[model samples]
Target: MAYERLYILVEGDDDKRFFEKILTPLFEGKYDQVKVWKYAQQKKEKVSQFLKSIKGMNADYIYVSDIDQEPCVTARKQYIQSKFKEIDKDRIIVVIREIESWYLAVLDDKSSKRLGIRYSNTTDNVTKEQFNDLIPRK
Candidate 1:
């Protein structure tokens, strides 16, 4: 099935760069089937505002900020559902703890195993700075 578009709403530049670098390559052939666009906030974007922006854009999938602010899982989930009321719950994937997870996902298998983590995934309560050290800057 061809995916119309996948819109990922990130909080900042780091999240945008990290995801595109890691996830984009993995979905190489998918480019023909799906298009991923990154939407970043100019300021502190509230969930309500972010959702509204995405809704206006008519995205097929919405990956929104789920982590950060150290919010608990329940709070994050609830906020996501409530804020993005117009979005399809199935297509709306809340990326809980994005920074650390996106970074870990792209790490070599040996590195991920040594770190006890995987790309596109992360351990609970991991900090971005801690994960940042593991990923070399280009």
Candidate 2:
């Protein structure tokens, strides 16, 4: 089914920014509207409640979060499914280890140099703290 609108629920401001930068270009001309919601402060229960409330909306929904220390992406995704069974299985994306890994994947040598951070291929082991350290404070 082709969706005219896409609603993305992300874990934090960084996740929102990452989606804005990445998905916008990747999904350009595909969706008539794209909205990203930063729900970092909400607990898992609250997030599930919000998802339940948004059911039947005329839009495609996507939830993105870091896998953290989960056994694997499948486990993380299954955990989310256990809480929000209404959500489409394909729309839930759990980044391996952390969302910073995604950021790292896109960062080139030039960008890393400009940001004054060394480029490290540490996606599998990147932690929230390490991710935060790499991001330049505004």
Candidate 3:
């Protein structure tokens, strides 16, 4: 039997929570179902391996990783596309930038400024802590 759910794989629990706290609401009841699989930072785990394992799950994936690798975004995207040629490129979003960027951008001005972040409807240097505080109840 099919899951009949829109599955999304994220890099970590934080990414999963972050997306749920924000984006999930936007998609509520908009589809048949919704789910998120968060990856753990295991010593032996490779991102490629993670991709391979989830490829057959027939779910959309969003890879939110730090741009610590060379030619980071392009490389990750190419690897995923080449490895899983059947998956839609748009369904696979490899964020070469840090996930903190997304979390910070969602905060209110007061919180952003308190974290020494300039939210001129633009950039920020806020960390995960600041993000958690913004969504304390969640």
Clashes of each: 3, 0, 0
What value of lDDT does candidate 3 attain over all alpha carbons? 0.61
Candidate 3 ranges with C-alpha deviation above 4 Å? 1-3, 40-66, 81-88, 114-138
Alpha carbon deviation, residue 58, candidate 3 (Å): 5.2
Estimate the TM-score of every prediction: 0.53, 0.78, 0.58
RMSD of 3: 5.3
Candidate 2's residue-wise lDDT over 1-138, tens digit each? 755777789988778888898886676578878888887787877777777765756567789878876788888888878977677778888877777677777778898888797877556677778878776788
**Per-residue lDDT of candidate 3, residues 13-118 (tens digit):** 7788877877777665664567666654543245456565557665445554444453766677776567545545666676545576676666688986786655
lDDT of each: 0.58, 0.78, 0.61
What ranges in model 2 sit over 4 Å off? Answer: 1-3, 43-46, 135-138
Better of 1 and 3 by TM-score: 3
Superpose all Cα atoms of candidate 1 onto the true structure and report the RMSD in Å to 1 decimal. Answer: 5.7
lDDT of 1 by residue, 1-138 (tens): 543445555656676676677666665565443334455544335545655665675534556565566457556756666755654556555566656655555567787678765544435545677676665566
**In model 1, which regions exceed 4 Å deviation?**
1-3, 31-59, 69-74, 105-123, 132-138
